[model samples]
Target: MRGGVNMSGWAGFSDEELRRMQRKGAEQRPAESGSCPAPGPRKAASSAPRSRQQLQRERALQQAAQRSRAAGEEALQAGQQLSEPPPERTSPGAPEQTAGPGAPSPRPEVKQSPAAESEESREEAPEVKELDRQEAEEVLRTRLQVLQQQQSLMEEQNRVKKDLLTRTLQLKSQQTQAEAAMLKTVRAELQQLETMATNDISILRGRIEEADWEYSKARKRYERAEAEFVSSKLDLHRKAELKEHLAEHLYAIIQQKELRKARKLEELMLRLALREEEREAGPAVETQLEAENVETVKEADFEKEAGTEEGAGSKKEAESPEL
Candidate 1:
């Protein structure tokens, strides 16, 4: 039969009551066994051995608790795995053993020893804290990895944006330069065409002015020539009329000279008859007849000279423009 109390009976007990019960049982064990009066040598020998054994057990338990506490502290600071095994939980139905039958029975108010309960609690507490530290460390590591991945992705996006911006600026600059060159070329061509048109207009205007001057000069020359021709025609008509009048006068003078010649011839015939009759009469009658013949010839020559001068003067007037 087990000489002990049940662990279920210790569940509702306070620590002070349990410790008081343990002291009472320890004091009563030696007296009830009648071994308290053992011979001095034997008692000294047995008590020394028992005291050493109890001290060893107590030191062992304290060392175990300290090691567990230290291990838990180190695990919390460094996130390392626990090397010690997990603590075992005591069942409430299990029995607790006493040293002998002479030991005092426990009081109704006492159930379990305070030292054992404390050792169990001390061992179990570290295990719980270590598990919690491990979970927290795992969560922190996961969050750090996610943050690093996001930073790398953002850097890549920025690089792509910068490259596109640079390309756009280059294309814009090239287009602007091309437009400027095209505009310059067009302006130059327009200026050249305008200059050519101006020159052509100037030449045409000069040619027209020269043509007008030549036409005016020709008209003036034509007018002067016409005036000269009209004056010459009028002079010619006047000269023709003067020539007709001079011809009529010359014909009348010639007829009168011919009649005078016929009359002189008849008078010469009468003088010749008279000369034949007076030839036998005397020499003085012949000399007076010769003198009369010379006087009549002189008168006829003077009249012929006057008529020739008038005819020559009329011919000169008819031929000259001054008439």
Candidate 2:
């Protein structure tokens, strides 16, 4: 019984142990089955998807950068292609494109608005701006100098014109004075000529009056001489007639005296003859008587004859001869 009891006990111990073991096994198995496998692969797959998305983003960024570099190169090449060559040199007064040796090439003319110029100036280096300002100041100085020179030239020209005008006025005044003097001299000369003419007229009048008086005196003397000549001729004719009458009267008286003398001579001859005859015949007594008688008769005749002759002679002498 002991053996059986021991064996039963052993079997019972063994069954109990087996039942605990099974329960532990069941618990361990359920526990082991309840714990699932870890989800590492799913996590890894999610992470891989996220990593690919990020790689795609990185490749897009790289492509954009490569395109930007290519465009920048194309722009640089285009800018170089569009740029023009330098312009040719030109002669003075010629077109800008004209070619010439040793001449400066034309530069591009840049026109800027106010805003653009301000921006460019701001962008310029400090040294370059300083140089440009100095150049501008020099240009202003040159312009000022030229203006001063022009003003001086104008003033000089004005002074010269004023001097010429003054000289011209002086010359005109002198000429006027000279003309006035000439007129005065001419007037004086004319006055002198008039005076001389008046004096000459007076002298001529006096000479004419004297000539008239002398002519009147000469005419009167000529008339007097003519009257005297006519009276003298008449007196000479009367004297010639008186002389002829006186000569005729004297011839007649001489003829009468000659006749008386002839008669007396005849009587004396007769008396003498008678006396001679008586003496021849007669005596001496008769001769004495005759002589006495003849004496007495002769005395009486002489006295009477003498008285008659004296009377005749006195009458003839009383008439004087005309011549």
Candidate 3:
């Protein structure tokens, strides 16, 4: 019965008392709630230095925030000081009072709290930055469009220049071909002219040869006529000499005939003279003869008578006387 009663008293102890007991136990066991249990004394010393470094970093951030608040309050006070002036008065009939040194200094206007001003500035800054960004984007887009237009214009200009060059070359080639054809035609005309000139020269040479042959024939005929004329003159001179000789011979023959006829007439006159003389001489001779005969007869009779016959003769004489 005594052991049971002691056990109940220990179980019924107060919570505060129990906590005190736990604290005591912790102190005795070398550990606290907010601290790590150290394996040894050296580890506990290392943890204490790390906790001091953390506390110093937190204090630095708090002091920076307080300085920013002080600077913002000073700027607000300076702006308010210049906004308001003291009250003034004017009397009727009195010269208007000019602003003077007697006037009260201006009261500073109340400014907004630091927290409100900071929030407003922050809001305005974001709006200005957005507007600048939009302007820059617009400028970039305009520049890109201008560059594209310039490229298209350059391509069109190149196409136009290429087409012009091609047309010029084609025209030049056509001109060259036309010039060549014209030159060919001129050369052909020149060749034809040369052939005609050669033919004309040959014909002229033939005409000259024919004229030379005719001249030679005419010269031969003239020479033959001249020879005939010379022969006729020589024959005429011979005939004149023959006629002179014949006339001289005929004159000589007529003189010889006249001399012979004169000789014959002289012979006939001599014959007639001879015949007349013979007739006259013949009668005289006859008378002489008769006388002689008478004489002779007488003589003869005388002789006869002288002889015996003389007688007879005398007789005959006598007979005759009788008759």
Q: TM-score each candidate.
A: 0.36, 0.30, 0.30
RMSD for each of the candidates:
25.6, 46.4, 47.0
**Total clashing residue pairs per candidate?**
0, 0, 2
Candidate 1, residues 127-227, lDDT tens digits: the string is 33323333234324433544465567778888888898899899999999999999999999999999999999999999999999998998899889887
Best by lDDT: 1
**Clash pairs for candidate 1:** none
Candidate 2, after superposition: displacement of residue 85 in Å?
28
Ten-residue region with minimum lDDT total, candidate 1: 2-11
TM-score, cand. 2: 0.30
- What candidate 2 gets wrong by more than 4 Å, as runs, is 1-162, 230-323
lDDT score of model 2?
0.45
Candidate 2 local lDDT, 1-323, one digit each (tens):
11111111010112232344345445544544565433663344345555543443333332222222233333354543222222222111222221122222222334546676565443322323223333234323433544465568778988998998999989998999999999999999999999999999899989888887887787777677666556555545554554454445444444543443344334433444465555553543365356446654754565466557656654544442322
Residue-by-residue lDDT tens digits, candidate 3, 1-323: 11111111111212342344345444533433344433553344345565543343222222222222222233344442121122121111223222222222222234566676566444333232323333334324433444455567778888888888888888988998999999999999999999999999999989989988998898888788787667656555554554455446445544544454455435434533554466575654564455456546755664454455434544554454234
